[model samples]
Structures are given as C-alpha cells and as structure tokens.
Target: MWISWMIIAVMVGIECVEAGLNTLTKVAMTSGMSDFVFVVYSNSLALLFLLPSTLIYHRIFLLGLLSCTAQILLYTGIGFSSPTVASAMTGLIPAFTFVLALITRMEKLDLKVKSSQAKSIGTIVSIVGAYIVIFYQGPPIMFSQSLPILHSPSESPLSNWIIGGFLLATSSFVISVLYIVQTWIIKDYPAEMVVTLIARVFVAILSAIIALIVESDPKAWTLRPDMELVTIVYSAFLMVTIRSVIHAWACRTKGPVFVTTFRPLGMVFAVFMGVTFLKDTLHVGSVIGAIIIALGLYSVMWGKAKEVEIIENSFICRINSSSEEVPLLQNKSIDV
Candidate 1:
C-alpha cells in the first residue's frame, strides 16, 4: 500500500516537474534560445551537477543517448510542426510505452484479466481526455478577474502538417522506447544516481555536438544572468537531476508502464499551471477533460494496486508453503 502511494506521489511530482519544464522551455525559446542550443546548455549544466557523484554503471549511457536523441527529434519536430500538433502527439507516449512493454515481456497482456483490461481501458481514456483538453478548448466556463489570464496567440499551422506529424509521431515513439529501456536497465543497475549522471553526460555530449553543427552565432552561446541563466541553472539541478532520480527510482521500483501512464497527468498539471501563471481562461472543455483524465488516472492506479496485491499474496503463499515443507522434512529426519 505504501509503495503504491509512493509511486503515485512520484508520478505527481513528475507531472509538476514536466509542466514547469514546458513553461520554462517556452520562455527560453522566446528569449532567443534555439531548441538545439537550449538542449546543449541544459544537458551540459545537468552533467556538471552530476560529475562529482560516484559512477556505478556505464550501460546507462546508451539509454541516455536514446533519451537525448528523442529530445532532439521532439523539439525539432515542434519547430517543424506546430505546438498544437506536438502537444497532441505527446499523448501517444503512454500508448507506445504500453505496447513496447508488452513486446519486451515487461508487461503481461492478458485481456481476460481484470487488471489488464482496466489498465488498457484506462490508458485509452487518458489519451482521449488529454487530446480533448489539448485540441479543443471551449469557451471560458469560469474566469478570475484578479489575474487575467492571457491565452498565448496561436500561430498558423505549418504547411507540411503531414511531414511534421510524422516527425512528432516518430519522436513520441522513440521517447516511449526510452522509457521502457531505461526501466529495464535500472532493474539490474539499480543505482539511480549513477544512471542519472550517465544520462546527463551522454545527453550533454550529443546535444553539444548537434549545437555546434547548427548554431553558428557565438552570441547564441552566451548566457546572460537573466531568465535564461535561471532556466539553465534551475532546470539543470532541480528539473533534470531531481526528476531523473525520481523517475529512475520509480521505474526501478515499479515498471515502465506505470512510469509512462503518468504522462497524461502532465496535461492536467499544465492546465492548472497555465491558469496560475499564464492566467489562461478556464474553459468548459478543460473542466470536462480534466474530470475524464482524473477518472482514467484512478482506474489505472486501481489496476496497478490490484496487480501488486496479487503478487504479494502469491509471494506470501509461497513462503507459507515452504515453511510447512521445512517442518515436515525436519520431522522425517528426526524419525530416521
């Protein structure tokens, strides 16, 4: 019970961290930090924070490279496409992760099992709810007069929506792969700090290589002691390190399916954060969609809890049976 709740708490924390990351990344881009440059700086700063720690695992570097590749492709996809499409595509992460987990034998696909069915249905509901909130914002249902929220102006969709859609979908799939592979790796390594550091180091190296090839202006490399600096520093230590450690621990303790299921919750968190910081309007669609998301989250949690309970029961039964056999064997030896 405690472990389940801990995983839930971690998921909530992840959502909060992700929401802040999205907001900060947007502001950084607005401040002339290209996606490539921001990735380089953020990952470099993260690596700096991680280098002093004792390293235990090297295999995590490969996972780190995959993660970095996904981020590069994802951000670049957003650049090629519209933010609308990117946001919508992110809802696919959990679905893709679920599929990969099944293929990798990390997750059992038993449609007849109640837990499995619940998990499957919950995933679909969450995905639907996320898209509803993202793609269709209805009129304001409620508005606070104190702090007027300004919905950021929407830009026209890219002409090559098909190409952009493909890029974003591919990026989402890669990210899903990262989630599964990272979790699988953690089962053996089980060193969260080491994994975190390796991930950051590799991401920094990759992002730096990409940044050099693309960003020519030396001024773009310069970081003023402003929001840009704040974004880099805060995102590096708190955002990357803390979030990565928490995720690695969760993936180690739980599974990739559990870790990825929380992605939809990010949409919920982003909505509230937007209302608070961006002072965005509270639309009816937002209200309904959030409720649906909450339902899906609850369903998923219930299914996961049931799965844990079943495992624990089987384990307890095995222990009891083993103890019974031990006493019988002891009696037989005494008789002999």
Candidate 2:
C-alpha cells in the first residue's frame, strides 16, 4: 500500500517533467530547429550522457531497435499532424495500453467490479475532456503580450488537415505500442538507466543517419548558442536520461495505465504555461476543458487506488487465514 502511494507520487513528478519537456521542446522548435534534427541531437546527446549505464548492463540490441523505430514514427507523425490531433490521439493511449496490458496479462480487467468500471469510465472521460480542450478554443479571456508567445515562423499552413490528423493519430498509437514494449523490455533488463541508455544510443544512431539523408541543407544541423543548444542539453540530460529513468521506474512499479492517466495533465500545463509564458490568450474552452481533464485524472487515480486497496486486503486476509490454520494442522499432525 505504501508502495502504491510512492508510485503515485513519482508519477506526479514524471508528469511535471513531461510538461516541461513539452514546453521546452516547443520553444526550441519554434526557434527554427527542425523536428527531425532536434530528435537526432537530443537522443544522441542523451546517449552520450548515459554512456556509463550502457557500459554496465549492455546486452540486448533488438529492444533498442524497436525504441528507435517508435521514436522515428512518433516524431514523423507529429510533423505531419497538428498538436490537437496529437493530443487527441495521445488520449487513446490509456485505452490502447489497457487493452494491450490485458492481452499480455500485464493488467487484469475484472469489469464486473466497480474499480474496473471506474478505470474504463476514467479513460473515456479523459479522452472526451482532451477533445474539448483541443476542439473548442473560445474567446480569449486573458491576453498576454509577454508569455504565451506562440510564434511559428517555420510552419506553413496545412492544406490537408485530415492527413495531418491521421498521421498524428497514428503517432499516438505508436506511442502506445512504445509504452507497452518498454514495459515488457524493462522487465527483463531490470536496469532502468541501462535500458534507457541503450535505447537512446540506438535511436540516436538511426536518427542521425536519417537526418543526413533527408536534410540536404548542411546549415540545418548547425547548433546555435540559443534555445536550440539549451533544448539539446536539457532534453538530452534531463529529459532523456534522468526523466526517462524515473518514468521507466514508475512504469515498472505501477502499470502503463497509471503512467498514461496523466496525459490530460499535459493540456492543463500547456494552457497555463501558454498564458503565462508564451503570451497566449486564455479561452473559455480551455477553462472548461481543463476542468474535465481534471475530473478524468481524478477518476483514474481513484479507481487505481481502490483496486490497490482491494489487492492489499486480499493479501492480508490470505496471510491471516494461513497463520490461523497453521496451529490447527500442527496439532492434528502431533496427535497422529
């Protein structure tokens, strides 16, 4: 039970880190860093940062390959799609993880119970709330000239929103697979730092090669002494190595469902951060959507907590019942 609480606490920390990751990455990308190039640099730098771990427990290479593939697919999909599509698709992760977990027996789906029902409903509510945030951008109640400075000088107008949406949705699904795969792979490796390092190394190599082939302009890879450098260092060291190790630990301790339930929190952070930092306007839709997302996060947490309590109680009951019968059986054996 105490362990469960610890997992929850750690998950909150992970979510906070993820929020910063999103914000920082956005700021860097907005500064004219190509997404593919950024991916390669961050992953590569992360590899360098975590090379020590790789030296200690390096074995499997296939897992690293899958990790790289997933990363490539994810960023590529996001490049093609809009952020709204990406978020909406990400909302599908809990559902996808739930289903995948059940199939792999990583999660038990006892739908007859109230806890299970709450989980199911929580996932749905979270997705709906996310869509609300993404779809309904009402009038700006607060405009910021300083923060929420959303400047996309790089992106051109998308002619095919549908295509972009599909791409992003696909990326979201790939992310779900990535989660499950990571969970499975880590079980065998059992070294979170080593696992993260190995994956990052593989991903870095692949991303760099791809970047070279696709990006003809040599100037694209140029590292400026601005947000780009900051993002690269921060993402490599903090985001990849440290943050990923923590997240992988949480995933191993809890289940993927628990890790994914915080997806909605990203929107919460984005809304607030946009208004405060990016000089963006706060809309009514954002307010309402934030509320809904909050509710959904609560529901998931409640359901998981309830489920944990039930399991602990059952375990205690078994131990007590076994102890009680132990003396009785001993007396009978002595008489015999």
Candidate 3:
C-alpha cells in the first residue's frame, strides 16, 4: 500500500513537471524563438548530458531513436497548437493505448468478462468526452462570472493550429507505443541509462535537422541567457530525467497500474497552473466535460483493479494446490 502511494505520488509529480514544461514552452514560443530552435537547443543539451551514461549502458542508439521520433512529433505539435488544447487532447492517450494493445494482441476483449467490458465502455466514453471538449463549443455558461483569458500572440490560432493539436495527440499516442516497446526492451537494461541516452543522442540529431529546415537565421543556434534556456535545461534534466527516474522507481516498487491511475492528478495541477499563472478561464461546458472525463478515468481504473485481483487470486490458488499435493505425496511415502 505504501509502495502504491509512492507510485501515485511520483506519477503526480511527473504530470506537474509536464504541465509546467508546457507552460514554459508556450511562453518561449510567445517570445521570438521558433519552436524549431527551442527543440534543437533543449534536446541537444539533454543529449550532451546523457551521452556518457547512455554509452555506458550500451543502449544509447536504440532508445535515442525512439525518443527522438516521439519528441519531434510532440514539440512540433506544441509549436502549432495552444497548450490547453494540446493538454486536453492528451487525455486520449489511454484510449489510443488500449486500441494499440488490442491490435498487437497485448490485451484481449472478452465481452463475457465484466472487467473487460467495463474497460471497453470506459475507453469509448472517454473518447466521446474528448471530442465533446474539442468540437462542441456550445453557448457559454457562467462558471464564476469571470471573463475569458486571452492567449499570447504565439497561442493565437493560426490556420494550422487545429492540425497541430491533432498531430500532437497522435504524437502522444506514438510515444506511448515507444514506451511499451521500451518496457519490453528494458527488461535487459537499466531504465535510467536507456532513457538518458535516448534523450541525449537521438533527439539531438533530430532537432538539428529540424533547426536547419525551420529557422531562417542559422544564428538562432547562438546561446543567450534567458528564461527559455533555464526552462529548457530544467525540463530536460530534472523533469525528463530525474523525475522520470523517481517515477520508474516508484512504479517498480508498486505497480504500473498504480502509477498510471494517478495520471489525472496532473490534470488538476495543470488546471490550477493554467488559471493562476496562464490566467486561463473556465466555462461551464469545460467544467462539465472535465467532470465527465474524470468519471471515465475512474471507471477504467476500477476495471483494471478488478482484472488484477482476478489474476492474483488465480495464482494464489495454483500455488496453494501445488503445496498441498507435495505434502500429500510425502505423507503417502512415510506411511508406506
């Protein structure tokens, strides 16, 4: 139980870091720096820091490749979309993951199983909720009688912003796949070493390529002291590496489900930050949509717990039966 709590706490912390990073990135875009430049520098620096340890683990290349692709899609998406829209779309990740798992036969759908049915229903409901949030801009209801907060210049909708948000959501789905693959591969490697190496090397190469294509002035690569640099470094090192390590440790001690179930905690943190720091406004529709999303998340989690309990009970029964059989055999030998 203690371990479970630790996992939840770590997941929550990671979510907070993610939210804060999003906020920082939004601010950076509002400034003169292009998303391409931001990605190049931040990832390049991260790669530099991670190279030594990654090589030591001998998994720098593979992990780097996967991480690079994920980052490119994600950063590009952020460059194109508002952080609020991007973050909300991320709620679709679990749904995407479930579909992928089914396609890959990593999980199965059994209509007869209550847990399975619940998971399927919950996933569908969550998807519907996301669409409602995204497209259903109905008449605004009064939440707190507050005016809507204005977005920064960068955050203002370009013709491509909607496309970018969709792309970002897709990027997140792809990254989740990479995560699943990493889990399979990391069985033979250290998580820290693998993650660090990938962040450092692979992403650096990818970002450099993007910089060349996107930035008009090659001089954008020149380093200058600013809040963006600080934010990037903090995000790359502390948020990406350090917090990830902590979360991995907690997940190992507890379980993946426990960690994953706490994902919504970050949403709460993001909302608070959005309101206070970014000065985002809330409407009744958005509020109601959030509540629905939360309920859907809970339903999915409950289904997962029930499934785990069933598996554990079956294993316990098997062990007990095996033990009883061994004792009976010994007694028969003694009597003979």
Candidate 4:
C-alpha cells in the first residue's frame, strides 16, 4: 500500500511536468513554424532519443504503431486549436476511457456497485463541467481583458475556431483509446521499454510524413539557436521519453487507475502556472468549472478504488479455495 501511494505520487508529479512541457510547447510552436513542422520535429527528436531502447526491447512494431497514430492525431488537433482549449478537451479522456472499457467488458457496471455508480455519475459531471467551460461566457469579470494575449490584435472570430476546438476534442478521444490499448498490453509486457521504443519508431514515421507534407523549405530542417528549440528538445527527450518511462513504471507498480487519477492534478498545476507565469485571466465560470472537474475526478477515483477492492477480494477467495482443495486431495490419496 505504501508503494502504491508512492507510485501515485510519482504519476502526479509526471503529469504536472507534462502540463508544464505542454504549455511551453504551445509557446514554442507559436514562434514561426507551422504546427505540422512542430509536430514533425518534436516526434522526430523523441524517436531519436528512444530508438536505442526500442531496439533493446524488440517490441518496436506494436508500440510504434500505437504511439505514432495517437501522436499524429494529437498534433493535428493541436495545430488547429488553442492549447488551453485542447487541454480542457483532453480532460474528458478519463470519461472516454471509462466508457470504452465498459463497452469492451473490461470493466463491469452495476447500479448495485457503489464504485460503478460513482464512476458513472462522475463521468457525466466532468463532461458537463467541460461543456460549461467551453460554451459559457458569463458576465465579464473585472479582470477580463479586451483581448487575449495569445491572439493577435486582428484575430479570427470565435465562431471560426469552433472546428479547431472540436478537432482537438476528437483527438483527445482517439488518444484515450490508445491509452486503453496500451494499458491492456502492459498487463503482459514490460511497459517502459515497449512504450519508449514504439513511440520513437512511430513518431519517426509520423514526423517524416509531416515534413514531406508541410516543410518544403530546407530551412525548416536547419537547427536554430533558439530557446524554443531547446524547449522542444526538452519536451521530446525528457518529457516524452524519461517521464513516460517513469509513468509506465508507476502504472506497472500501481495499476492504470492509480496513475490516471492524478491526471486532473496536471490541470490544477496548469491553471496555477497559467495564472502566475502567463498572467492569463480567469473567469468566474472557469473557476466553477474547474472545481466541478476536481469533484468529478475524485468521484472517479472513489469508484476505481472500490473496483480494485472487489478484484482483490475475488483473487484472495480463489487462492484460498485452491489451497483447501489441494490439501483435501492430498489427504484422500494418503487414506487410499
């Protein structure tokens, strides 16, 4: 149990780092490069860093396919939408994962089961909160800026950006599927090496495709002595490779739900950093939505805890029954 708590702590820490890296990546991409170029370069660098590990593990194919597909969709969505919007949409990943797991019968749902009930209610609540965050524009707060810092003085209309936000949300859904599949694979495989290797290979292929499509200029390949490039490298090598390895290790030690529960912790950290460092204005509705999200996250965790208890008890009972049967069989043979 102590070890489990430690693993969860590590997962939360990793997620926090991920949020920071993601925030930095968005800033870097806004510099000059096309979104496609940023995606390609980021993935390529990650692949280069992870190649050796993948070769060592020999699970290059499976991991590569899954990671590449997910990353491609994720990057494409990011290219289309605001980072904040994208992050908010990604908050729905847990709900998507839960629904998928239920559909596949990987998870059982019963009204009589308190955990299941909690999870169901939590998922619905979190989704509702997300919609409120996205669609609601309450009375202008005192701090409400006339213009968003991220947007140019002459920016596109909000209605025009709806498609981009929707694309990002769809990307989040696809990512959740990949995460679920990866979790299932990790049950039988060494997750660290497998995930690292696959990410490297798949991202390599993905980057090459993006480069061919968007970066026709040879100058795009030239390395610039820019801080943004450094941030991208850090995101690729440390955030993608090192942190991911740690996350997989934690998941193996603690279970996927234990790791997943800490996801919202990232959002909390992101909000804090955004307000402090980026000077992003927060609205009353956004604050309320965030609180609701936290509540929903807690509910999901509660449900998952109950599910884990049920599974543990079932395993214990089976083990005890098997032990009893073995002793009885041995006693009968001795009498004979």
Best by TM-score: 1
- lDDT per model, in order? 0.77, 0.73, 0.63, 0.66
Q: Which digits, one per residue and each the tens of the lDDT, describe model 4 over residues 48-97?
A: 77776655544445555656665555555554555556556766776777
Q: Could you tell me how far off, in angstroms, the CA of residue 249 lies in candidate 4 after the best superposition?
A: 3.8
Please list the Cα RMSD from the true structure of every candidate, rounded to 1 decimal place. Answer: 2.8, 2.8, 3.7, 3.4
Model 3 residue runs over 4 Å out of place are 47-55, 60-62, 136-158, 243-269
Compared with the true structure, model 2 gives a TM-score of: 0.89
Off by over 4 Å in 2: 1-3, 59-62, 73-88, 146-160
lDDT of 1 by residue, 3-53 (tens): 778778878887777766666565566666678887788878887778778
Any idea what lDDT model 1 has? 0.77
A best-first ranking of the candidates according to their lDDT comes to: 1, 2, 4, 3
Model 3 poorest 10 in a row by lDDT: 141-150
Q: For each candidate, what TM-score against the reference?
A: 0.90, 0.89, 0.83, 0.83
**Per TM-score, what order, best first?**
1, 2, 4, 3
Top lDDT prediction, candidate number: 1
| Cα error of candidate 1 at position 308, Å | 1.0
- Mind giving the per-residue lDDT tens digits that candidate 3 earns over 88-171? 666666666666667766567798999888777776666566555555646654333222343543545676686787688777
